[model samples]
Target chain A: MHELGIVFEIQKRLLAFAAGNGLSPASIASVVVEVGEASTVIPKYLLECWPAAMDGTDMEDATLEVEVIVAQVQCKKCGTVYPYLEHDKICPSCGAWECRMVTGQEFNIKEILVYEEDVPEDGSLGGDPAVR
Target chain B: MVKVYEIKQRVLANNDSEADALRSELKQERKFLLNLMSSPGSGKTSVLMKTIALLKDDLKIGVMEADIDSAVDAQTIATTGAKVVQLHTGGMCHLDAGMTRQGLEALDTDGLDLAILENVGNLVCPAEFDTGAVKNAMILSVPEGDDKPLKYPLMFTICSVLLINKIDVLPYFDFDLDLCIGRVKELNPDITVIPVSAKTGEGIDEWAAWLKNEVTAWRDTSSSETIIAKNKEYDK
Candidate 1:
């Protein structure tokens, strides 16, 4: 499935991101991703492939967090904004045929949740990183 | 220790940039790339074969058939005497812009004025991907019914040309052509719809003439700056 291919691409990029941040892959608790509603990506398939793609890798136990961005379209003639699928391009208000897509079609890594230990101002050997 | 990192990076940034780069390369090479996407059994090969027959004398043509398995389509296209190559997606449903680049490299593009990528058959995935083509064209056969535009609006939305294939079967199939074209135009304000049938060779000349015009126009404006002109529509 294409989603599996996309999963591998995301995983590869995530590993690079983790390395750039000087953090071990295991330090990532979850990788949050935002997928557009109109993007042809099936979230269910992506979730199904995530664990399989991460197996035996540094992110083996990491969770895959998904966020769906809704598709929005604005009518160029009527200046009305609505769901892209609802009206596509024809404005529901003025019956115009021109519109601009404002959102959706996005696929990106939004954030990375990491597990880390906090150190005290004195550089204590045993300070819980969670304890700011 | 735990902290969150905000790395808001596009997952397909590599694909977008690669597609842009490929666009520039195609312009520099004087190649007019056209990606054809349609559902399986939509006569994409038939249309392309007919196109080859019609334009072989006037234009140098090359084709790349993308499929998950088998080289049947590529073999069929090869019979037309045009330079052709087959691309295997290794189970991927769609060919991303990166994959299309690999296919271009494999095909003999030297002195070819028109190169067409018969993209994987599935309508949904192909529309979501950009193959760095100067123009995007898709085919919708009459047998598929007119309701397809409602179901697969994204395909109709992104395509600049919608080839309504199998018009010969219009009487056999209950297809409303006007309704279909109207729905498609609503999604894409600037789409040119051509009704044709590869079986009867009806409307093939018009399609060929359209291709000739587009090909020469692409070559005339071949430049790195105008390579991504279509994308500039969104930048506004």
Candidate 2:
């Protein structure tokens, strides 16, 4: 439900980043994003919201790459860390309910892949210098 | 040739910063904004009516009701004679800091001591985005079951106060109050849990007292840093 808003936010940031770097929106190859398993942001929903967010932005052809981070929780009682979903919010090692989430609630933009045209070594702005 | 830009930034960072800025702005205006969230049919409107009845005489209160599409909540809250505004999220499930700011502006909260933003009824999306409120609260009615904390950990974790509403119906339902509070505490150690029945007015005094104290304390404090620091302490 919230994925549409998130996609718009990502698109806004991408626009600003592209502007700052002097890159065209079409030059962007793929946008990489990392989401934690516990972040409540479903990667599937983000993917579904991507096309609508990119529509009319001139970057609809660009791809969205989503990377999910597994959720881990650290037991406060026995100082043991384990995967959260595997143990059901309990310390797997100590069998205790007291535990702190160490990781998983993360939503970040990792990087952007852009295709830059190769320029000739003679300082001339040429189209595909290697092809010539 | 492909060039990579290693921009490792949080997707919600922009919203977070905007929330912080709105917090500071509200602090400067001496308005204590409270973002109330819950699932649908959680008696949020009923609780708001009761709360307004209790504290409206003591403080200048304004309410901004956010819904995907509805003016019903605004109409209900208008009966209390307090300032009220209805905000349509335009099909969005949650209200971000920007939308909250726009709502506040529409309400014209100049000298109000408390501005309550009744967020859209959804446990997931609202908790993920901060509405720039001084505090976050959610209501979990007995009929909603006690295992909600396990299902919606982020919602349980982000809330500063958890109001276990519909206590009057506890005799009919199989909800375990102790186990529910325990589960919530496991997720958030510092959360204040209050069991209230908005219908019979049970525990409304304590909830109203808490809000009154928060509003008064916020006005007494001169520095915005103190408020931010205090909020940050429980928000973690």
Model 2 C-alpha lDDT per residue in residues A1-132, reported as the tens digit of each score: 788889999998887777766667777778899999888789999999999889877688888999999999888889999998888877877798677778888899998877766222443421221221
Off-target runs (Cα >4 Å) in candidate 1 are A72-102, A117-132, B222-227, B232-236
Candidate 2 chain B: 10-residue stretch with minimal lDDT = B227-236
CAPRI-style quality class for the chain A–B interface of candidate 1: acceptable
Per-residue lDDT of A1-132 in model 1, one digit per residue for the tens? Answer: 588888888887777766665667777788889998877787999999998899999889899989999988788788899887667556789987566668887888887777764212444322123321
Off by over 4 Å in 2: A88-90, A118-132, B230-236
Deviation from native of the Cα of residue B139 in model 1, angstroms: 0.3
In candidate 2, how many Å is residue B137 off?
A: 1.1
Provide the lDDT at A108 for model 1.
Answer: 85
The global Cα lDDT (0 to 1) of model 2 is 0.87
Per-residue lDDT value at A111 in model 1: 77
Judging by TM-score against the true structure, name the best candidate.
2
